[model samples]
Target: MLYGLSYIFTKQATAVASPLALLGWRFLLAFVVMSGLIVVGVIHVSFKGKRLRPLLLVALFDPVLYFIGETFGISHTTASESGVFLACIPVAALLASAWLLHKYPTRLQVIGILITLIGVIVTVLAAGASASLSLIGYLFLLLAVVTYALYSVYVDKASAYTGIEITYIMLTAGAVVFVTMALIEALEHGNPQALFSLPVKHPSFAVAVAYQGIGSSVLALFLSNFAIAQIGVNKTASFIGISTVVSIIAGVLLLGEAFSSAQLIGAAVIICGVYTANNTFHRQKRQSQIEKKSD
Candidate 1:
């Protein structure tokens, strides 16, 4: 749900700060909070004896590539267009998980995934956005989807790592990459000092940064990794694109955006899809546990 809110606050942050600047501080703040948690013994991460390849790849795929693509893609495209693109994450994630982790979804789960995807397309297109973006924009969005999928699959593959550990490294990498990007952009504009001053000057950026850095980056990514570890990727990815629905609902409730009947129907379809997929998985899980206990 916080991912949905990230969309809303991202608009606010972008209004006050460049995308790279906003992402830099957003993740830098998250990294700071994560560091404090480690220092305070609130969270623990271990890197002893484990090869760094999987962890590094996971971080590279996620906060690094995913954000770069997503940030730029949304910038060049309309929000509704981006929503339709974001809707493809679960399907891509599912395929990646199946190929990489060998975690195939049940037929019923695939149907549910398709249902949710159709609902997202319906909801997004109901806004009547024309398909009119440059090829580069479309390619960026595609990169975002593919990188996000790879991230989900790698997180599941690296099941030895705890959620805290995965999220810690992801945020650390994000902070470094985005801060450097922000620095480069600032330099190109001949205003490097803006990186430090602009965020402090804008109250809107401050509020957006707090929520995005803490709630969305730190907590949400941790939960996502935990879910992927526990439930495997496809099941967790089933609800991946539901953020579009949540963003719409949030806009209606918080920002007083108009909510249409088609949107309401689309939201219901998404919920039904998620519930149907997870419900079947739980039932099968329980049945297997019962059989094991009987033996």
Candidate 2:
């Protein structure tokens, strides 16, 4: 839900601040909140042997490349178009798992993936003539999907090896990257102060930034990492399809956006696909575990 709502906030915030500037403030605040949690013993931080490189890679894939692509992509493309593309993250994660972990998706899972993709296509097409497509915007959104998929896989491994401490490190690294990017964006705009000034210039921008910082960045990241660690990547990724549904609802409620009947049907189809995929995965996993125990 936070991830879905983040798109709405990002769109609103980007109206007042550059994507990089919004990201800088978002992650900076998230980092501070996370650090305070550590200080108060709400969460512990530890970096033991041989985990730094993978943790850094996860950070780079996520907040750095993923946000750069997603923010810029949404700024340039229609929300429907962006949502359609972002819906592909689960499929990308499935393929990444096949390649990286040698864990190929089952036939049922493959069918679910195809159905989910078709549903997203139907939903976006139902948005009608207003759904504009920008090639550059799609390119960036695709980058977001790929990089985030990679992050999903890597963060699962990192979490297993080192626990949720990696979340803090990832957020810290992301904060630094976005702060630098914000400065560069400000420089390009001929006002270096815009990095810090823009958030204060608009009240809505500040609220959007804060919601993204605490809800989306900090809480969502922790939940996602915890889910991946507990259930593995394919199951975790399957739930991403529901974000499309959440995005649609949020658009209607928060942004006052309208959806066509076809889009509504598509949303239902997406939910069904996610359910089918996750259930199939769970059954197969249980069978595998049972067989192993018997052996």
Candidate 3:
């Protein structure tokens, strides 16, 4: 739920700040906090040489690009719409898995993916008949989905490195790139006030940016790394399904956004679909293990 709230706050934060500025603070704060953890020896840090390339890839695809796409996309679209699009992530993972490994998706997996599509449609309907969403906005959200899908797959191969090391390296790498972009953006669009602004414009906005950087961007990565370490990558990825329901509830309660009946129905449908998809993977994993044992 902490991770889910991160998305909600991110949507609200971007309302008052540019997405790049938001990303800059988020990466910077998260990088600083994580660096502290390492320096204090609160978290043991280590990396595997063979896994360096893939970790870098996950960083680029997930943080550098995905965050940029999602933040800007939310600015352009409604939270409801963004939530619906984000829900497709798990389904995207399934499809990618099938494509790359020739893993035959179960009938239930296919059905779940289709049902989630229906949920997205219902959510969009709840946005209203006349809601003017731009295609550019939708494109950005889709870009997030695409980048994250690649990250999801690539992270599996990144297991040669510990999740802690991967998280630190990726965030640090993303921060370096984001900071450079932020510096250039600040220079090119030099409204000195905007460039040097702090907790003044909207302190809540600053809080939002900080929360995204430290909570969503940093802590989420930490938890994901821990989860993937304890459970395997595929198992940990199932938890991502929780983000859909979490986002809607948080959007409503925290952001004071109202959900239409259609959205409620969509949320319920998404829950059912997530259960089906998660179980499908679980069953397949168990079956594979059993087959290996038999051999």
The best candidate by lDDT is 1
How do the candidates rank by TM-score, highest first?
1, 2, 3
Give the alpha carbon lDDT tens digit for every residue of 1-295 in model 1: 9898787888888887899998999999999999998999988999998878899999999999999999899888887888899899989998998898787789888988888898888888776777656688888999999999999988877877888999999999999999899999999999998789976788888999999999999999999999989888888988875787889988888888898899888888888778877888789889999999999
Error of 2 at 265 (Å): 0.3
Pairs clashing in candidate 3? Answer: 26-213
Q: Rate the local accuracy (lDDT) of all candidates.
A: 0.88, 0.82, 0.73
Q: TM-scores of all models? A: 0.96, 0.89, 0.82
* Poorly placed runs, candidate 2 (over 4 Å): 76-80, 129-135, 159-163, 281-295
Model 3 worst lDDT window (10 residues): 230-239
In terms of TM-score, the best-performing candidate is: 1
The alpha-carbon deviation from the true structure for residue 244 of candidate 1, after best TM-score superposition, in angstroms, is 1.5
For model 3, residues 1-295, the per-residue Cα lDDT tens digits are 6776777666666677666766777788889988998899998876634746878888888788887788778778876677667767766766666665455567776776667666665765676644337798899999988887777777766778777787888789778977777777777887646744744777877788678777777778877766645654444444565566677788888678888787788778867766765686678789999999999
Better of 2 and 3 by TM-score: 2
Cα shift from native, residue 294, model 3 (Å)? 14
Clashing pairs in 2: none
What does each candidate score in C-alpha RMSD?
Answer: 1.5, 2.8, 3.6
